[model samples]
Target: MQDEPTPIELTKAVADFLRSDITPLITGHQAFKLRVAVNILDLVTRQLTQEEGSDASEVERLRALLGMDGSVTELNRALAERIAKGEVDLATPGLAEHLWATTMDKLAVDQPSYASYRRELSRGE
Candidate 1:
């Protein structure tokens, strides 16, 4: 029987993808998007690896870093909703792509004008 992959392996795979594949595809404002996504993923992975029990403090820290003011419960609920809606993709060889897609989707949804702004920005208009 084959052994299941460890969490570290999965996280590493995602990190590798972000550094090796996704980073090169980003340009202009999308570069910022990618950077934010990578940062979030790194935080989540760190919490998962280093902490036991629920990582509410880590989530709260992330929320604060993102300029969100919310309880850990609220942040977790939002993450769960995004995951349920297929906004976050966690099934790739690396979770990084899913994280990036989800972050972009959330940003677009939260700020309806963001996509247009990014498009214009990318065009250097």
Candidate 2:
């Protein structure tokens, strides 16, 4: 539905330019600030690239687990309420796997380099 240089690509370009070009021209506090900005941009790019598929998977899992249809938010809320009421727990079918997959997707956007994520990722290989 869109053209080349998609939002994620453009975001990565900006982050790359800031990291490779502008960062070297700055110093001390400004450099640190720029690094943080670039990091945020990179995170945004990752989220833009991954959010759709991750959300789809989450919705599918929630639908199957809840045995009903609704928006992702609604399904998640239902799941939360079930868990709170002791109707669902880690022992519930697919619950742990769904939670782990969802958390991994979030970490892929928030902190891909996190040690626990890295370790878990390695185990899948």
Candidate 3:
């Protein structure tokens, strides 16, 4: 790995700079696009920082729920197949909790400011 600032840190810094500096100077469509760009950068930073831990937790939950060993992608596919066949679902032990955790992790990265996400996050604490 490289030294000093991580990729997430660099991206976050750039996004912060854009939000604090460039965003106020523009107007109309350009400003909207700039905001979108900054948001995208922030999302990327979150994913870079959070994905590994969230994915590992998801894999562990999947292994416990399914009683199998595989990569995260494989386990997820198996889970989806089982769900489609009515073999595994919310009624299954740990299923609902696992799904909720995964969804919350995604929302944390994708839209932390979303009202419902914020409410659920606070409720968890």
Candidate 4:
């Protein structure tokens, strides 16, 4: 196993440092670039923290919905194909819940702070 200071922790530390310390010192286009860098770091940290669990849950949901086993990507492709062929639809058992879970996981990584996302999360939907 790895030692202390995991990737998520390290990334958060760097992002915090940049946002609190260096950002105030930068200016103009460089400031914008630094802000972008901080955002990237924050996103990376969130992924590092959440990706494994979210992906595993997604794969599990996909397997249950599709009644087959495959990697997440393969299962998703199979699902899309089935959907396109009219083999599956919103009426399928667990389909809507699976889609919602998958979408929430994506939003958790990509836009956890988005208004709608935050509202939905707060509502525990």
Quantify how close model 1 is to the true structure by its C-alpha RMSD in Å. Answer: 15.8
How many backbone overlaps does candidate 4 show?
0
The Cα error of candidate 2 at residue 121, in Å, is 0.9
State how far residue 80 of model 1 sits from its true place (Å). Answer: 26
lDDT of each: 0.59, 0.94, 0.93, 0.93
- Pick by TM-score: 1 or 3, better one: 3
* Runs off by more than 4 Å, candidate 3: none
lDDT of 4: 0.93
Would you list the clashing residue pairs of candidate 3? Answer: none
Report the candidate with higher lDDT, 1 versus 4.
Answer: 4
Could you arrange the candidates by TM-score from highest to lowest?
2, 3, 4, 1
Query: How does residue 10 of candidate 4 score in lDDT?
Result: 93
Count of steric clashes across candidates, in order: 0, 0, 0, 0
lDDT rank, highest first?
2, 3, 4, 1
CA-RMSD of model 4: 1.4
Kindly list the per-residue Cα lDDT of model 2 for residues 23-86, writing each as its tens digit. Answer: 8899999988998999999999999999999999999999999999998899999999999999
- Candidate 4 residues 1-125, lDDT tens each? 99988989899999999999999999999999999999999889989999999999999999888889999999999999999999999999999899888889988888888999898898874
Per-residue lDDT, model 1, residue 23, is: 98
Among all windows of 10 consecutive residues in model 4, the one with the lowest summed lDDT is: 116-125
List ranges where model 2 is wrong by over 4 Å: none
Which model, 1 or 4, shows the larger TM-score?
A: 4
